[model samples]
Target chain A: MKRELTCIGCPMGCRLTAEFNGTEVTEVTGNGCAVGARYAREELTNPKRMVTALVRVVGMERPLSVKTEAPIEKRLVFDCLAALGAVAVAPPVRIGDVILENVLGTGVNVVATEDIGG
Target chain B: MNMKTKRVDLLIIGGGPAGLAAACAAREAGVTNLLILEREDALGGILRQCIHNGFGLHTFQEELTGPEYAARYIARVQELGIPYECGAMVISLSPERRAVYVSRTEGIVAVEAGAVILAMGCRERPRGALGTPGWRCAGIFTAGTAQKLVNLEGRMPGKRVVILGSGDIGLIMARRMTFSGAKVLACVEIMPYSSGLKRNIVQCLDDYGIPLLFNHTVVDIHGRERLTGVTIAEVDGKKRPIPGTEQEIACDTLLLSVGLIPENELSAMAGVALSPATGGPVVDETLATNVPGIFSCGNVLHVHDLVDFVSAEAARAGEMAARFLSGEKTAGERIPLIAGNGVSALVPEVLSKRPEADVTFMFRPRAVYRNARIAVFRGGKQLAVKRARILAPGEMAEITVKQDAFCESEGELTVSVEEVGA
Candidate 1:
C-alpha cells in the first residue's frame, strides 16, 4: 500500500510518499531531510502526538493549561482527553506540576504548563 | 492629589513572548531600568492560552507548546530580575515616550522612558469585521476566543462547530474541538488556498478526516438566541457568492478565524506612522518608528505568522532601544524597502545604511508560487537573488542582503518574485 503524507517536521512541508506492505517494512521517499524520513516511518508504525488540555482549577475562574511531557500514541489522544476531562486540580499550581500520573498506563504524565495561584 | 511618577530607561508594552524577550535583550544590552506593562493577570499573554505544541522550533531548535515556550522566557526574565507589572493597562503614550497607566494596585501611574518598545501584539478579526448576515448570536465566537474558552477556561463552547476561514487558529480549533468530542462539520475558506501553514492543514484537519471547503464562505447565519447553523456557499473568483451553490450545515457554534490585525492603538497615540498595507507601524531597519526614541516589534509592527520570528525581531528592537538609550551611533540616510511583484507586505518599511552588517528583509508573497526567485533590485539593477522551491502567502520569507551589496547599491531597494522557467 502507498500513502502520501505531508511532512510536518518543518515549515518546508515536504510532500512524502510512504510504501508499506501489510504494515511491514517499506521505503519512504520525497522527504526534505532525515527528520522527515524518521517522522514518516514513525507515523506509519505508531503515530504519536503531544496532547494539550485544560484541567479544572479551584478558586480560579479559568482552568490551568497542561500537556504531556512527550508525545503519546495517536490512537490514545481522544482517550487521554476523555481522561483529562474528569480531572481537576487546586491552585497554587506551579509549572511542571504533575496533574495525571501514568495516564491510561501509557507511562506519560500530564503536567501543568502554567502557574495558577490563589 | 499628586500622581506617582516612575522613570525607566526602557518601557515595553505587552509581556508576552515579544515583550519578555525584548526585556531580557535590552537588559543584557546594558539597559538596567526596564519596565514591562502587561494587561493580563499574569505574564505570557496569548501563549498562556495556546497550549498546543509546534512552537519555538526555530528559536529553541525543539518542539514546545505555547506555555512551555513562554515559560522558558519567563524564567529567564525572573532570573535576570527584569521588573514587570502584570494587570497594568497602559492608557496613553506620548511622542516624548511618556506613558500613563492604571492598575488595581497602582492608581494612575506615569512613566518617562528613554526609549519605548511597542510589543502589543495582534488581535483576531471578530465576526463584526466580516459582516455576515446573521443575528447577534451567542454561540458565534472568534477562534481565539474559543481557544481561550476551551484551553484556559476548560469550557466547551459548543458540541457542534462550523469554522469559517481556514487560518491557522481556525484549522487548529477544528482539530481541537474534535479531540474534545465536538463534531466539526466543515472548515470553510473564501480563499482558494488556505491562509494557514501546510503542516496545520495536514495535522489539524486532514489527520482527523475533517472536510476543508475552499473558495467557500458563510453567506448567511441562522439563529435567534444561539447559533443553529450557517449557510455556506461557493464563491466565484471575485468572491461573490454563486447562486444555487449554497449549502446549509447545521451546527450550534460558528468560529471565525478570518485574520489578525495588529493592535497599534498605543503606537498611534505615540504618533508613530502607520502602514496601511501591514496595518501596523512603519519602521526602519532597527524596528524604530519614525518617532524618535520609539521602536516597535512583534505583531504590533506587523502581524507575524510565527512567534519565533517575533522574538528574533523584538530582540533586535531591544538592542536598538538600548543603543538609543546609551547614545550609540546608528546608520544614516534611510532608503525605502519596496515590495514589488507577487509580494504583499514587507517589515521594516525602510532600510538604514548599516555599512558593517547585512540587513534581512522579511516579507509575505501575494500567492503561492512554485520554483520562484526572489530578486532584490536597487536603481533598476539586480543586486541579489535567492531561489525558493515554493513560496506561499501563509509562510513569511526572508532574504539577507550583504552590506557590500547594499553599500554599493543606490536608491530604494525593491524586492520582487519571478517565476523560474516561466
Candidate 2:
C-alpha cells in the first residue's frame, strides 16, 4: 500500500510518500530531513498527538486550560476529551497541577497550564 | 504622596519571549542594572495562553509547547538574577527614554534608562477593522481571544463555528474546537492563498477534514442576541463581494483571525519614525530607531510568523542597546535598503557599511513564486543571489550578506526577486 502525507514536523511541510507492505514499512521519500521520515513511519502506524483541553473551575467565569503530559494515540483523542469534560476543580489552581491521572490508560496525565486566581 | 524614581542601564517594555530574551542577552553582555516591566500578574505574556506545541524548533532544535518555551527563558531570567516588575503598566514614554508607569505594589514610579527596547508585541485586527455588515453580537471573538478563552479560562466560545480567516491562529483553533467536540463548519479567506503556514493547513485543517474557502469573505452577520449564522460571499479581484454568490452558514460563533498590527503607540509617543510598510519602527542594521538610545524588535518591529525569529532578532536588539549604554559607536556609514520588484518590504530599512559581521536581511515576497532568485543589487551590480524553491507572503525569507560583499559599495542596496525562467 502507498500513502501520501504532509510532514508536520516543521514549517517546511514536506510532502512525504510512504509505502507499506503488510504492516511493514517499505520506503519513505520526499522528506526534507530525517525527522520527516520518522514522522511518516509513526503516522502510518499507531499515530499519536498531544491533546489540549479545558476543565471546569468553580468560582471562575471560565474553565482552566489543561494538556496531556505526553502525546497519546490519535484514535483516543476524542475519548480523552470526553473523559476530561466531566472534570471540575476550584480556583487557586497553580500551573502543572494534575487534573486527571492516567487518562484513558494512556499513562498521560492532564495538568493545568495556567494559574487561575480565586 | 511621594513618587519614586528608578534608574536602570536597560529597560525592556515587555516580559514575553521577545522581552525576556532581550533582557537575558543584555544581562549576559554585562549590563547589570537591567529591568523588565510586564503588565500581567506574572511573566510569560501571551505564551501562557498558547498551550499547543510547535515552538522552539530553531532556537532549541526541539518542539516545545508555548508555556514550556517561555519557562526556559523565565528560568534563565531568574537564574541571572535579573530584576523584573509584574503588574506594571507603562503609561507614558518620552523621546529621552524616560518612562512613567503605575504598579499595584508601587503607586507611581518614574524610570530613567540609558536605552530602551520596544518589545510590546502585536495585537489582532478586530471586527471593526474588517467592516463586515453585522449587528452587535456576543459570539464574535478574535481568534487570539478565543484561544485564550479556551486554553486559559476553559470556556467554549461556541459549539458550531465558522472561522473568517485562514491565519495560523484560526487554523489552529479550528482543530482545537473540533477536538473539543465543536463543529467547525468552514474557514474563509479573502485572499486566494492562505495566509497561514502550510504545516498548519495540513495538520489543523486537512487532518480534521475541514474545508477552507478561498477568495471568500463574510458579507453579513445574522444575530440579534447571540450569533445565529453568517452570510459569506465570493469576492472579485478588488475584494468586493460579488452578487448572487452568497451562502449562509449556520454557526453559533464567528472567529476572526484577520491579521496582526504592531502595537506601537509607545513607539509613536517616543517620537520614533514608523515604517509605512510594516507599521513598526524604522530601524537601521543595529535595530536602533532614528532615536539615538531607543531600539525595537520582535512583533513590535514586524509581525513574525515564528517565535524563534523573534527571539533571535530581539537578542540582537538587546546586545546593541547594551553597546549603546556602554558608549561604543558602531563603525560604519548608513546605506538605505530598498524593497524592489516582487518584494513586499525589508526589515532594518537601512544597513551599515562594513558591518562587524554578516548581517541577515529579512523580507516577504509580494506574491507566491516558485523557483525564484532573490538578488541584492548595488547600482545595477548584483552583489548576492539566493535561489528559493518556493516563496509565499505568509513566510518570511532571509538572506545573509557578508561585510566584505559591500566593502567597495557606497551606494543604496536594492533587494528584488525574479522568476528563474522569466
Clashes of 1: 0
On residues A1-118, what C-alpha lDDT tens digit does candidate 2 reach at each position? 9899988765557899999775866799999889889988888887888887778887776777778988899889889989988998987987788999999998889987766775
Q: Show how many residue pairs clash in every candidate, following the order shown.
A: 0, 2
- Compute the lDDT of residue B406 as modeled in candidate 2: 81
- Which lDDT value does model 1 have at B357? 68
lDDT of 1 by residue, A1-118 (tens): 9978888875668889988775653888998779778888888888888888877787677877889989899899889989998987987988889999999999999998877884
lDDT of 2 by residue, B165-280 (tens): 99999999999889777899999999998889877898689878899999999999999999999999999999999999999999999999999999999999999999988989
Model 2 clashing residue pairs (backbone) = A63-B153, A63-B154
Error of 2 at B51 (Å): 0.6
TM-score of 1: 0.95
**Which model scores highest in TM-score?**
1
lDDT comparing candidate 2 with the true structure:
0.88
**Docking quality tier of model 2:** acceptable
Model 2 residue B335 CA deviation (Å) reads 2.1
